[model samples]
Target: MIEILSPSEITRARATGALVGRILQTMRERTQVGTNLLEIDEWTKDMILEAGAKSCYVDYAPSFGDGPFGHWICTSVNDAVLHGMPRDQVLADGDLLTLDLAVILDGIASDAAISFVVGQERDPEDTALIETTRRALAAGIEAAGPDARLGDVSHAIGQVLSVAGYPINMDFGGHGIGTTMHQDPHVANDGRPGRGLRLRPGMLLALEPWIMVDTDELVTDPEDGWTLRSVTGARTAHIEHTIAITADGAEIMTLAPGASS
Candidate 1:
């Protein structure tokens, strides 16, 4: 379903978005070598509860996933990219970590993700992958404006990733998000411009651009049935933010206060 937020709904959305952004930022800062994945999830739960918000993922069960997610946040590390279920493994130095979070405040949901290295031991490839995804996400947001077609946003994101030499995964991408977590007007990472759903004021979209280092293929972890890792086990990265379509342009709802770009 495509949901257009009323003025009051938009105000609540901003609040929810700020909460999600702050939670992800805090999680990223807290995640380091020796930190357990479960610890991260715990932190997320605490923060969500402190904000008096609901988790969009904890009880989320979709066809692709095994069952209810049963977790507060998605802790995807190294090869893992999307839907990563928290585990007991402790993070090591230089491990690439991606934190994806979604929450509802005042009945409006906001979603966002961030990819970063665990320690100072950053690998060039890992850093590049993360930077590429961030750039792609920015490009997609730049293309999202009132009257703009969904394809325009997809095309912009794909252009950046392709130029960076990363393959785009079509299986999962961004989508409309509002009172519920995932909604209609599927936004692919790559598509032909001037096609697909046309943007309108008050529309909310979670635009995410993720990529695996070597291939576009993905293999779900058989044990957890949630983590989506690269088939080649190569490094991966993801960047996302919840955006609201406006008359003049797109307003990024999930950015931290004073955050640049």
Candidate 2:
């Protein structure tokens, strides 16, 4: 369903968005080589409970995933792109990590994700992949505004990833988000700018741009039943942010406290 949050609801959404951002930021900072993915999930759980916020995941059972996610955050590492269920694997230097999170605070929910390299080792290819997704997310946000066509956001994201020579995967993309996590008006990574739903004030969207290095195909890890990895085993990246359409333009509610726009 497409949900246009009321002004007061939007206010609560900001708080939810801020909590999501801060949790992600803290988790990223605390992560290091030898840090287990499960530990991240635990950390997220503690923070959410401490803040009296509800996890959008953890008990989430969707058709695409195994029943009950049972995790506070999604830890997608290296070739793993989306819906990565936290496991026992320890992080290694230069590992490309993506942390996706969503939570409800005061009955409002917001979602966001960030991809970064863990430890001191930096691979140029990994850096490029992360940068591409980040730029694509920015482009998508820039295309969103009152009265803007939803496809414009998709086009903007696709243009950036295409020019960077990455294959786009549309199986799972951005979507409307409000009181609950996922909502209507599915936002694909690529589409015709003039088509699809028109933007409206008070509408909230989670704009995520993700890509695989060599192929668009995805193969789910059989063991976890949630981790989506590249078919070619190439590295991948994802970046996302929850934004609110306003009278003037878009307001990115999920940015971390000290994060630069």
Return the TM-score for each candidate structure: 0.99, 0.99
Off by over 4 Å in 2: none
Q: Write the per-residue lDDT of candidate 1 for residues 1-261, one digit (tens) a residue.
A: 899899899989999999999898888878888999999999999999998999999999999999999999999999999999999999999999999999999999999999999978979999899899999999999999998999999999999999999999998999999999999988999999999989999999999999999999999999999999999999889889999999899999999766765
lDDT tens digits, residue span 134-240, model 2: 98998999999998999899999999999999888888999999988999989999999988899999999999999999999999999989899999999999999
Residue 137, model 2: Cα distance from true site in angstroms: 0.6
Query: How far in Å is the alpha carbon of 28 misplaced in model 1?
Result: 1.2
lDDT score, residue 206, model 2? 95
What is the Å distance of residue 166 in model 2 from its true position? 0.6
